[model samples]
Every structure is written in structure tokens, then in C-alpha cells.
Target: MGDRNGCSTPGGGGSALSVMAGAVIGAAGLAWWLLSEAERRRQQPRQPRSLRLSTLRTPVPAEVGTGTSSEPHERDLHDRVHELNQAIDDVRRQLESMNTQA
Candidate 1:
């Protein structure tokens, strides 16, 4: 079968035209959406310099150390050191046991 305008294939011309039109419409829609989004972002309210400076000038509260001890920082450090010593002892015992077995 042949198409009008003396073409050999059927429906080829109409399909190609439809594809081109769809692509053009899709491109136009994407461009419009991007431009609108950019315009909206440009129109948004920016943070005032005075508000930003004030926030920067405010003093932050002192951070409290973790743990329930009276001297939290010293107690935390002591506990950590004790834990490390215990771990060292455990490793030494393991090494001794391995040497005896060998």
C-alpha cells in the first residue's frame, strides 16, 4: 500500500510531523517552566543584613560536658582512661594465653 503525495510507506509523513510537533511543544513547556521558576526565585525576600548580623553577634551558651559526675569533664576523662587500661590488660592476657598454647 502507498500513501498520498506519492509516498511508498503508509502513515510515515503524518507520524514524523506529529513527533516533531510533540517535541517542540515539550521543549516550549520546559523552557516556560524554567523561566517561571527562575523569576519566582528572583522575587523571593532575602534575609536583611541587620538580622543576620544580630544573629552572628548573639553569644552562645556554654556547652555542658556529658556524665552525671560532679566534675563532669574530669570524671569523663578518668572513666575513659580506666576503660583503656582494662582493654590493654585484656589484650595482654590474650597474648599470654596464645604464647602458652603455642
Candidate 2:
């Protein structure tokens, strides 16, 4: 038959242009994919070191209080302080008794 160029379909001349165009399109698609992957990595949230238990492992004393110091916190703090003082007195009496026995 004959192509639209009317050359009777000999070898081919425009085939190289088609190959180059396809290569350009493929390269552009690859570039876009790489950019999208990079953007996804950028948008990902990072893991906070402070949220880990090991990072917050401070040695707290046994008789220490752990109440919030906000305003509106009234009776709870007073009750805790009173209870802690009683416990401390009880321990002191026990230690004094042991010392007297020795």
C-alpha cells in the first residue's frame, strides 16, 4: 500500500522522531513519579522521641506527689498533702522505735 507521506512505505524516516518522542514522554513520567515519591516522604509525620516511655523514665521518689498545679484544683491537693504528712510521721515513729530498741 502507501502511507500518508506517499512514499510507498519504503524503509522509514519518521520512526526515529517517534522513538525520541516516546523516550521524552517516558523520562517526563519518571521525573513526575520521583517528585511525587519525594513529596510523600516529605509529608510523612516523624516519630517524636518524647512520646517514648524510655525517654521519660525519671526516677521519682516514693513519697512524692504527682498532682497538677492548675488553679481550680483545691481539696485534692490539700487531702494529698495531709495524707503524705501522716505517712511520713508514721515512718518516723517506726524508725525511732527501732533506734530505741538498738
Candidate 3:
């Protein structure tokens, strides 16, 4: 019997084996290409770690309102907020004392 392409049956020739070998070679080539591409990417120099504003540890300004303090200290967000609140309270107290004296 003949196939759709009018090719004779597998018993007439080793067409089946040839097709299988071609498929195997194609698969191997694809795998090799993928591996080489991966290796090429691995060899390329990676981009340097980009600087992010969020990651930066900018020093907190000292004494909230005076605007005169130049010294800055590296403190985390929570601690810096606490310090600001304390400075605000201190200023309030100072204002009250001045008012009472007046």
C-alpha cells in the first residue's frame, strides 16, 4: 500500500527510521541552540545594582522647627518619627512656659 504522498509502505524501505532520525536530529539541534543561548547570556556582564531612592538611608534632620540644626543622623523611619514628635512636644512646652511667664 502507498501513503498519502504515494510513498511505498515501511517494509519497502527504511523511511520510518529515516524520519525518526531526522526528528531526533532536529530535537538535538534545538536543545543545543537553547543551551548555547543560555550559556551566552550567562557569560554577558550583568547590570550593576541600580541605586533606588527607597533603599537610600538619608539622615533625619535634627530639631524639627528651628531649621538651624545642620547635623543629621541615620535613623529608621519609626525612630525618626518618634524623634520629630518629641521635638514638637518640647517646642509646645517651651511656648507654654513663655506664655505663662508673660
Candidate 4:
């Protein structure tokens, strides 16, 4: 309870003055934090962050690559495989021809 002279006795269980003081201090703290952030942003303006994109491309079978797919890496791989198979077939034919001659 306050005295007749209008002075708070500080034991009246959270007087209006304490509440006002707490509100003012909280407001000042918030204002200070906002100003610091603004100053930091002004010194180094926010840049657009670049996100890295990841590819999940894994090599499948050559036959799987050749039919309907048109990716360059897959097509190249399929062609190289086809060339190797053709070379192997030619070597087998030559060896058979030699064996027959013997």
C-alpha cells in the first residue's frame, strides 16, 4: 500500500513504477539489438546465397543407355562399349579362321 505522501514503499507486491521501468528497459534492449543488426547489414549488405545443385546420375547398363535415352555421357559410354564388343568379335573370327587353316 502507498503512503499518503504518494511515495511507493517498495513492498506492495510489484507497483506500477516497477512494471513501467521493466517495460522501458525491455524496449531499450530490443531497440539496441535492432540497431546493431541494421548497422551490420549496412556494413555488409546481404547477398543472395548461392545454393549448390547436386547431380544423382549413375552409370547404368549400355543397353539401358542406348534405346530411348539421349544424354551425351550415356550415349558416349554406349558407343565406346559397342566399339569394344565389335573389336572382340573380330578377334574371335580371326582366331577361328586360323584354327581351321591349321
Report the number of the highest-TM-score candidate.
Answer: 1
What would the per-residue lDDT of candidate 4 be over residues 54-90, giving only the tens digit for each residue?
Answer: 1224554354544655576778999999999999999
**Whole-model Cα lDDT of every candidate shown, in order:** 0.82, 0.75, 0.74, 0.74
* Sliding window of 10 residues with minimal summed lDDT for model 1: 61-70
lDDT of 1 at 82: 100
User: What ranking of all candidate models by lDDT puts the best one first?
Assistant: 1, 2, 4, 3
TM-score for model 4? 0.32
Global Cα lDDT for candidate 2? 0.75
TM-scores, all models, native as reference: 0.38, 0.35, 0.34, 0.32
lDDT of 3 by residue, 66-87 (tens): 6545434334666789999999
What is the number of residue pairs that collide in model 1? 0
| Per-residue accuracy of model 1 over 1-102 as CA lDDT, tens digit each | 455555767577788889999999999999999999998777654446667788889875566676333476788899999999999999999999999999
Please state every model's RMSD to the true fold in angstroms: 12.3, 22.4, 19.1, 22.6
Once fitted onto the true fold, the runs of candidate 1 whose alpha carbons sit more than 4 angstroms away are 1-7, 46-102
Q: Highest lDDT among the candidates is held by which one?
A: 1
Off by over 4 Å in 2: 1-11, 46-102
Error in Å for residue 48 of model 4? 33
Cα displacement (Å) at residue 2, model 4: 99
lDDT of 1 at 20: 100
What is candidate 1's TM-score against the reference?
Answer: 0.38
